[model samples]
Target: MAVELQKKGNFYMGEAPGMMEMGISNKNLDDDGRAKRTGTLITASAHIITAVIGSGVLSLAWAIAQLGWVAGPSVLIAFSGITYFTSTLLADCYRSPDPVTGKRNYTYMDVVRAHLGGIKIQLCGLAQYVNLVGITIGYTITASISMAAVKRSNCFHTHGHHTKCNVADYPFIIIFASIQIVLSQIPNFHKLSWLSILAAVMSFAYSSIGLGLSVAKVAEGSGDVRTSLTGVLVGVDVTGTEKVWKTFQAIGDIAFAYAYSTVLIEIQDTLKSSPPENKVMKKASFIGVSTTTLFYVLCGCVGYAAFGNNAPGNFLTGFGFYEPFWLIDFANVCIAIHLIGAYQVFCQPVYGFVEKWCNHRWPENGFISTEYAINIPAYGAYNINFFRVVWRTVYVIVTAVVAMIFPFFNDFLGLLGAASFWPLTVYFPIEMYIAQAKIPRFSFTWTWLKILSWACLVVSIVAAAGSVQGLATDVKAYKPFKTQGHE
Candidate 1:
């Protein structure tokens, strides 16, 4: 009469008498019966850094330039604070009834389901997946821009800076798509720690280079840095309507820069359960956000100082720093490398969602479920799924083509930020926290949270409108795949 016990979420349940005879041991499995999670603070931080410090960082200088001296830094800091707060709230939602021992919510959608459990889940999924897809597209455009910048930098050095270095972005877009097609085959988030680490390093590398060059430009008294209290004067710099749209777009760009909540739970799912995933995630968020905010302030402010009212949408690729041609080329190379890894970080969830749905929908089909073990001499035995290869390749190709069609980087980033910032980053987390914590109706805390959420909603709406206007303007003059140089 031996009693067999199996651990569930926080309780152990009695199994059938002969369960142990099946030779299954709980020692190597977690409560949910998956392989033990081995993630630590470092790995989780790497993932956050990889996701947060992405192509969005490149547009901050332009964003700052649009908002001017006071509003630029102020908005950046406010976004950082809000992101960190919402992140902490989202972290606690990683588990259910209790923060530490409750059932695990694997994805952001899972969290919404557990707490809200309605059409909200579908809304969350839509916001999240669409944002992820948008980010991948944005990254593609950015990577190609960086690639083109490298060639342009070398060209500028050879032929003068005044020479028209009209390098087409289509070829570079294809090259970036080719690189992503290979990297997208990385099975899951658990296997991306090393890649995340490398990408984080590249992010820091290019960010530092951008910062250094901006500082150099300022110190040398290089250009006419015409900064005003309010950014881009109405008539002198831009029309009144243009100023308003640029300002709103700037807000969206900053919003996009702080966006990582969509992937926070995914990152938390990788953590080892000892120190508690929520605690570890909070610390990681603090570290990641703090580090990136410091970089953002430096890059945005110094870049503004360097180029003033003429700050480029992309700090490095915008030809603002042309003298140090070699340095600029190196920075662009780092940007391309960093984005290569970042593309996977954002898109892995999308890949997982599609694969999971396919497997569930057609469980018995070998085409979707089968993984082939193909031996590669140098790389050891690898499991290759024909479906994954085809699907992911097609996905990358589609994104590449779309990027070529509309490669307006700043406007695109702003639109993505505006679209996802409120729903995915702010509203969902606050709602989940309020529901889980059981805050009383009309209570002080509840009221404040509602106000905060609504305020962000307003921000999102304005940002989206601004971005749409910018896109309309760009499209009127844009020639799809024929876009070249800094048009």
Candidate 2:
């Protein structure tokens, strides 16, 4: 074939037989040099919700405790807007013109490598995996706690007294991780849409149940000295740097609650794209963030209203005082189910990256003998080889081991948020949007937006610093193999 040359972004491509689309199509595309787009707005919405809400929702009450009432809602709303805008920015950059294929770019790392390039892409990968593994660990810890709580609740309700029921974190972590190992074998993102939908529904169910329980506690006067809206700021120790430090911690939690940008591009790739517009992805981002924000506000505000400064980091942990044990147990079960599905959803990109690397490094492997052909009516055929069986099991084992080592719920949340939030969620999106859009930094309209982005970065840095300090302190006080909130 005759060769043609073209430039897209910072790279040049030559159009010839097996030349232009060499690296881009390595793992993502099949024989036709195209990736399957099989997601609709609904499925995309489910994935977004599944990514955005998890154990983080359970940490919002503790966030409220840190930031007080006025600041709590304010930070939540601010982070919501920031996340939605950044997510849409990510969607916009998902595709770029190709010399031969017309357009390409399927993963978040793809977008980063295209725009930022060099060591920046490596940095993005590091931040991404850190965030992903951190999220999985958090989910594992939360699932174990929820399952253990169910065991304890059953014991209390059935046996009538607090007997020695040793339902610790390790066994439940192993159980949930094993379940995740099976779920992670699903091979592709589009197939996980149904699972994501179920996860999203589960998130809403438990959130509603928790909100209802909080309201009931307040209404029945059984809650511990409930307070009004003003009570959020009242008695808060804003004296000296204590208030500043607490506010930073609150920022970290809020940022962590909204830290779904790590997987936004992968989710966008699942959308059906004839002309490859991001309109559907944008809509999905909006709907998912809006839905989660509503739940975060309801859960955080109500929990704070009920417990005030006494609210534990895990909202369910506060149920130690509430009545009607069945409701709490039911809600915990919902949380566990949601986390199981969320675990698979979030881990898909990581799984893909590792598999792609393996395929690249060892293109021919003797161990891969079995292949299952998957047929999608809209997107044609794909293959599932045996390597999935090996890698996903290992991934689950690593996560389970980590979860057992440090099951401190709120402390890990702070650490992960602080470490990855700014780099992955705030910095990359803003810089890439500015580069792709070519927004003039000197102009009045662009100046303030850039400043706002910088302000977000500054806040994230402060929060990350605070979280690091907090995590170190918690590590020193940590008791290995001990379940959080049990002792």
Candidate 3:
């Protein structure tokens, strides 16, 4: 008798007798001999939406208020166009040599390693993982703010609007962290489709709620709404320097909102290979980016029209919409739910990277490489790894603690967006595309791409500086772990 073997990661397992007769065959598997990926355009779009339409949307009104009527919409549109274009380029890089028929690149770092190896791989990993970590921390802070807002909203309704419904954010941060710790145990990106779908729905719910509330406020003509062609007035609304810094920060906010590119390759990897992953991913990117841009413009413009220069950093949680307390609470709850899924979508890659490294470095170690199957009621047998459990829990805790320390939502978002926008979103994609396409140096196409990359780099620098300045100013008044929310 002959033995049949199946490869699983770096190890091999003996095939059960008559497995082929039991309807398990290579025909049902992908080219890589793994389970065939069933993800389609819709799932990819859902993942993109879940990743893109996160806490960043809450800060748009404030961003638009800083830029005003003209530049606000214009900049938002510009980002949409740029992001969609660059995203198409990135989608093509999911395969090496020949995109349609070539071998697949499973991660963003893999894509980099294939096209532009050497130190570039390290640089790409650092930028990507660091941005992902920053985003998770931001999500933690934002989720806690929304949770606190829910409590504060009910308090305002029970009491009066003028009452100082001061709520400490620490408790909510712990609560959010606790939930993430549980959800983080769900393994990898392939298993998160259901969660992403639910989260995408939640994102739409909250974003629509914010947009509707803003439109209602505008129509009712209740607030002292103001409008300007050039945005906030220099002397009346802010100092000249303040205006400049805020304008740059506003750019960062918009840039951050459009930043799903960091995870493009990872998302693309989940798609079935039939129609070409690049083709499906490109279409998904268009749909996702377009949908989010529409929501962003409506929310940012209408919210600004309602609050003008006085727009809150977070319209829902910043007490911009105080009446209809239940609706406010519901919207905040939706935000919290959305962030929970968004956090996992961003953090899974980091988790995967570390776990892969550990497993490779200690292939023979049981602690790092072993998995135990545990049976649970209502849920079938599940594989558990002690190392994964420990590491992911610690990761969640660190992010929660950091969120408690610096909860300056707007400034922190601006900084993360600025620091990541150019390298991860703009620079790497262009460089990879150029290298893979073998475009002639100094040619028109190469020249324009280089120019665009450099221009975005400059934008990132200014935006980061402004965000740092804002953080410095905020830190002077903020005490770590003692921040209070007032409605």
Which pairs of residues collide in model 1?
A: none
The model with the greatest lDDT is 3
Q: Tens digits of per-residue lDDT for model 2 on 1-487?
A: 2222221212101111232343565455433354445788888899989888888888787788777677789889998998888787777777753312335576778888877788988888998987898888888888999998887777766776455544567888889988988887676676788899899999988888888877876676754554444333434534545555656776787888887888888887777764354788889899999999999999998878766766777767434443577888888999999999988877888887776665545544534323455676796654445567787899899989988877777767777777777777777877777777677878875787678778877887888777766667678887665455621
Clash count, candidate 3: 1
lDDT of 1 by residue, 336-398 (tens): 999999898898888888877776676556666655666778977566767788999999999
- The 10-residue segment of model 2 with minimum total lDDT is 7-16
The number of the candidate with the highest TM-score is 3
> Model-by-model lDDT, in order?
0.87, 0.74, 0.87
Model 3 bad stretches (over 4 Å): 1-8, 11-24, 480-487
Count of backbone clashes, every candidate in sequence: 0, 0, 1
TM-score of each: 0.94, 0.85, 0.95
| Candidate 2 lDDT for residue 294 | 93
